[model samples]
Target chain A: MGLVANAGDSRAAVVDRPGAVAVAAVLGYLVLDLVVKLSGISVFFLGMQVLGGSLELGSLLSMVIDGLLVGLAVGLAGIGLSMTYSILDFANFAHGDTVTAGAFLGWVAAYIAAGLGTGAPIAELFMLNSGRQLSTVSTFVPVLLGLVVAGVGSVGVTLLVDRLTYRPMRAAGNISLLIASIGVALAMRYLIAFVFGTQTSGVASGGLRITFFGTVSMTDNEVTLLVVSLLLMLAVHLLLQRTKLGKAMRAMADNEDLARVTGIPTERVIRLTWILGGGLAGVGGYLLVLESGTISFNFGWILLLLIFAAVIVGGIGSIYGAMAGGVLIGLVDSLALIWLPSGLTRAAAFLVLIVVLLLRPSGIFGGVTTA
Target chain B: MSQRATVSAEVTLPDPSERLLAIRNLDAGYGDLQVLSDVHMDVADEEYVVIVGPNGAGKSTVMKSVFGLTTYMGGEVVFDGTDISERNPDEIIYEGISYVPQTGNVFGSLSVRENLEMGAYILDEVPEDRIEDVYERFPILRERSEQDAGTLSGGQQQMLAMGRALMLDPDLLLLDEPSAGLAPDLVEDMFDRIDRINDDGTAILMVEQNAKEALRRCDRGYVLVQGQNRYEDDGSVLLNDEQVRQDFLGG
Candidate 1:
């Protein structure tokens, strides 16, 4: 009975304070183990091999690169999620489906543009598995057009959704709005599935591979994703830092009541928030497809958990926090492959999120808000 | 002060035609919770008016009602001969009035410059001259132009809030408890700044918890008790009245 009580107390303590010593021990062990494995150094305790595995330095480098690319996509999408959460004061569950919508809209445009002169039927192009090859190098114009369309089209969809569903309930409590968003998510998901069949398919042909430092290799699509995501991130930074509308957004996020009294058109700001966020999610979704060379109806929905994990870990309302959290979650998701199977990498990411929340409930950028 | 008091006794208020703002039979409050009932008040052009009251007396509610931040049950808020009781705050701002809330008035996470810029968000371009004027009035804000408002001391934050409201260069400015959270030393300095602003000819409507000090400084004062008007007189008369001093002022 005494032993049972002690176990229960420790369990309760983990929920309250979270055993810092235990967390540190686990983290230290993981680090030490990773280092040992990377260095190919074995540890022997009492004539028994306790730690070490053959992890190549090259493989680790590739993991980091892979993690960075995926992180950029997740981070880009997270910017919109974080903005809406901050400005709208609700967790929009439909955000993931918005991404899916962007991907489909952009991919359709790309396919139709690329197969324009080809004798292929319009339906085959719409199906996105046309016999004609398409890649960044082969179909640059089509890809560019697709990216633009993705952003603009998503903006339209978000605005319409807000007008039809959210605006009427603007004064409602956060829970009502959140639950309403969940319903929106379901409606959008099924609508997309109905319009574009549910089956996933490879859409892009592999482009040129660029080698970096004579050691690391990256695909042309990956490089494109890198440049575009970085440029868009910079644009976002400028918008938030230098523009009047952006400052109003930050101010509204800081204190809505004050914003209203200060004579800011709250409705206009809300519309702009959706426009900016929807645009980012749209572009981010298109770029993810560009990198992965595949398109699906539900990829965005599947990616939603990871996006949310990033947002919460970084701090819900902070843009920079979302970016940082996205990269961290992405790196952890990829790097965890070293120990766990690829299927379980998502689980590893969530474990890290749980640990992070237990350590700092507000997240890494909690107090700083939208700025 | 004595000579001014003698002149105020035979007071010739600016004609009602020149009144900048008039609140008649005002009834307003948060949804389902009435706070202000049949409240009547007025501010003449360039007039400096202050509202003083005990806690929960609806002084702030009156200010908010004028700004259209509260639900209007029945009232007429006329500004410059235009009925504006039905207008929203955004529209009211265009009518040449600006409001500075008692607290959370400044955008804490934004830079001082950004906070000031947000104040003029309704304008097509950033008015550099008005920004300069605000900086000239509050030199500390100029030095901390790029710093976030949240990092400032309470006194500095209050100054920033005032500067933000001044960005639009409104004809009438409503300030709610500008001295509420200031250190005792800073309160006098804050009141002096308001006096200077009013002296420059902008009509001032303020609600202050610092009754004695507010009454001493305003041209006219209104004593609101439990959401109803209790007294209206020249600041000097209210300050000297035995009943007013005993009940509202901590004599």
Candidate 2:
């Protein structure tokens, strides 16, 4: 009884744990030291890597700019994945392929528009098999048309997929739906490979580059991607926050049965969910290839893991969280190149995801299903 | 004008014998588990009906079956001369029936205004006058129109749920446990608001746990036990019935 009384509060043992204290001390010390170094006047450390390394104010700002551009693309792609998870109550493994579908569809349309009757065979143009530079400069009209076709084509593909596959198996539960999505993903990947072939090809032709600050030039490709992605994201935000359809989406996410009972037309809402999710995913794919200058059948499948990482870290079902999480993932993936090998940067970002999930299992914006 | 006439001409006034909602020999359940058996009930035009019973007596299931939310095994649900027994909820909405579930009736993440907007989803445009009437009916909601429904107090959320259902100005409104989580003082206010809605000519079919209070306000009442009808009488008659008072109302 005396020993029991001497135990103090129930948390006494945990508080006295030496390992926890050491980790906390190290993390705290690192943060404080970094803060001191950034102040630049302190000069507390002997080495340059500890004090500054190659990260100058100019370079850091440039790095932030670079990170943000790619981050916006990641965020834009993550929105559709987040929407599907929240509204449909399942993770669509095929979403990445949907992005690829949009990108390829848009590219084909661009190729046909630019190369039609200009000494290039229609077959080669449609297949995108030839080595052609279809850039913003050489194919402005076709590129803009491609963007439109990207949005339209993906919408068509998604709606068809929903009608053929998802709609029928909706009541089969999330696990079955998830497994079904994996099948869809494989089918889509191989189909694209079948059509476009397994070869990696360059799509966009490079245009002008404008220097922003010294040595930090904004390529036309980056600017175009940035502007288009940001505008779409803004449109999505406005649609969700200020429109009737958006509210219905949110309501369905909250409770499908209540939504139906309240005359919200739950089935119609589900259809709309697929439409928007598929549409955004298509645009995301189109933008990814436009920015990266390369297109492959499996590019989207490869990028799916990173996009999923962003969605999970941002809070699985939250659109805004997806965007923020995407940017954070992008930045981490970019900035990790400073400390680790370029090949290991993706691994670092994923490790960060594991750590964050350990600390906040619900994620940065979880528990709020405002789709 | 011709198109409008053509659209409106299809509908005619219903016969007087046809009640707003008529449930006969309803057998419903979730999956294979039968929760209600041979449930029979009726609500006339503008009539207020209340179903009261003990826990797991399938009081809510009866309401759910009427709304086509439960699996129908047998019998039929006839609403406004239409055998809506086989109809789904989306089709039933066009029949002018709105149901508010006990829990999760309102979208917690959506703002009060957005939740209300979602209620009028079938309409092409926002009905401003109806929104104003709803605001007048519950002024507290107007004050917190932009606030998230989740952030509201229990009483406010209950009001918002009722308001959302009322957005359609439904012919028949199904309410399950309207006063379940309310503050003691707010229960009467909720009842009074329901009375106002009923007075405005909207038929109400409610399932409540508070038998005595529910009986006091409703026009007619049904006592259900073990998924079967125990008694059916005028609210005052059941309140006064010695058997009902001792068994269900705990007098």
Candidate 3:
């Protein structure tokens, strides 16, 4: 009997270490995530809902899934953010405005497609109408069209920004660059508001909801968003880790002079970096609109702090760090209402960012610093 | 002192020669500031040619001008019969002129193998056989192929820089002060490796501050003063000249 008890106790001890580790990881993630949500001012509605005792297993799962999607979206945004840091070596203050511009373009393209009457080759393929019925495959069509429009808009804005603002500022160095970028940001904000009008717009059509596990229901838009974000993040990861162009980008970030000496066309690489970074921001804007069903001229600007916090927490110029940081920030922002007021969630992210900056200035992942 | 004599003896050996590289009246410098003024030099295809001088003698500027890093005010830089003065650095590299700067020379964040791959960036195609050949020459690099270049020792980093430049199988290699901050023993080993590099058929045009040692290893030597070539002679003749030895070599 003693032998049997001893064997059981030994087995229990063996299992306890892994269990403790898993629990610790989850709890740590929860606390960090809560801080981000509070910092972002998103915990108000969440607080009310939780206080009303309306949080059920199904609701919790749905919230978790929503948080996951947001995290993935932010991670995708992180790739673009990392690239921006590489090219300019400073936060492109106008980046959020560029995202809004892409969103506006996506909206315009969808509106134009809707007006051309369904079934015309271009109209039928690209249009998103409120009353239109979509088949399983057709559900994917609007998102793709949105992505294409956003990508083009992003590349155009990026080029323009480089020509008008970044190029001159780069020659002048850091402080002048910062001022110019801020000027571009403010100018872009007003420009987007003027063109798109000062009203909110929705990108998703009312569609059939797919129910899973007899309790979880998701719309076509949400599923589209989640899948698209995942695929894009995967593609970006592969591009940065596996390709020659990616290696060149890393090298430039490490040592620009050495990269130039090694035959890397520095100007071309800079252009490519802008296009890619701006394009990702554009996609993030479009995804946010699809998920929330509403977007305004200030959509990206409002999210700027959260995004900045994510990038900073992850470490500047580190793609993997950005992704991890984005997801972590997103989860916290989405779930903070569980324990705190909604208005304070966003600020929590900033607090965490401050702590990270103070403690580990190199960030969670050690970033490559150029001499 | 006896050990120094033996190392100097080890450096005096010579090999067969062919035309490696030639530069004529290479006037080049940064914007508005002339660093090299009408300097002329040559290295037989398989010869080691070292340019030695004081700190401000423009030795590095000479290498930079040849590699197209600096603008040439006038004169021709011919490498393998191609006039490269008008070409960009990458184009010059394609024309078989490889340059390794004095400091921060390697891409620090890249692995040893990646640095080597980047060395051959100008080539339309990279032959795997050449990589294996370089590995055979620097076995230490092979052991640390996956390690970052920045973590390597100064001497090891210099070797990696040279190995990277050789990846394109260039006919001529330009080195700027390879022994800049090495220990005495490491400097000796570095000179020996340079001699081996020359023996393997790449002509070397190097700027070194260690004048006596540089003069001991090279077939010919040039002394530059204030961006102009002041003296040129056979290595042994310069080593034996009283004035050359006193003024430059600190003998």
TM-score of chain A of each: 0.92, 0.87, 0.78
Every model's DockQ: 0.66, 0.55, 0.36
DockQ of 3: 0.36
Candidate 2 has a TM-score of 0.89
TM-score of every prediction relative to native: 0.93, 0.89, 0.81
Candidate 1 regions exceeding 4 Å error are A1-24, A46-49, A131-133, B1-16
lDDT string for model 3 (A1-371, tens) is 12223666656754765443444455666655445544443343644622122345566668677777777767666667776776557777787777788877776575455445544555333323343433224455555676789878887987988997788667676667767878888899998777556776555643658899987888777787788877787887677556777667777777777677677777777887888888888888877677777778887888776777788778877777777778878877766657669898777667667766775787776455321
- Give the lowest summed-lDDT range of ten residues in model 2 chain A: A1-10
| Better candidate number, 1 or 2, judged by TM-score | 1
Worst 10 residues of 3 chain A by lDDT: A127-136
Candidate 1 docking classification: medium
lDDT of 2 by residue, A292-342 (tens): 888999988988998999999998998998999989998888867656788
lDDT of each: 0.88, 0.84, 0.74
Give native contacts recovered, as a fraction, per prediction.
Answer: 0.81, 0.83, 0.43
* Candidate 2: regions farther than 4 A off: A1-51, A127-129, B1-18
Model 2 residue A290 CA deviation in Å: 1.4
lDDT by residue (tens digit), candidate 2, B1-251: 11111112343424424777888878999999999988788899899999998899999999888888889899888988889887888788889998888998789889898888888888899888878989999999999999989899999999999898889899999999999989899999999999999999999999998889989999989999999877887888888887788888887
Best by TM-score: 1
Candidate 1 lDDT over residue span B119-212, tens digit each: 8888999999999999999999999999999999999999999999999998999999999889999999999999999998899999998999
TM-score of chain B of 2: 0.92
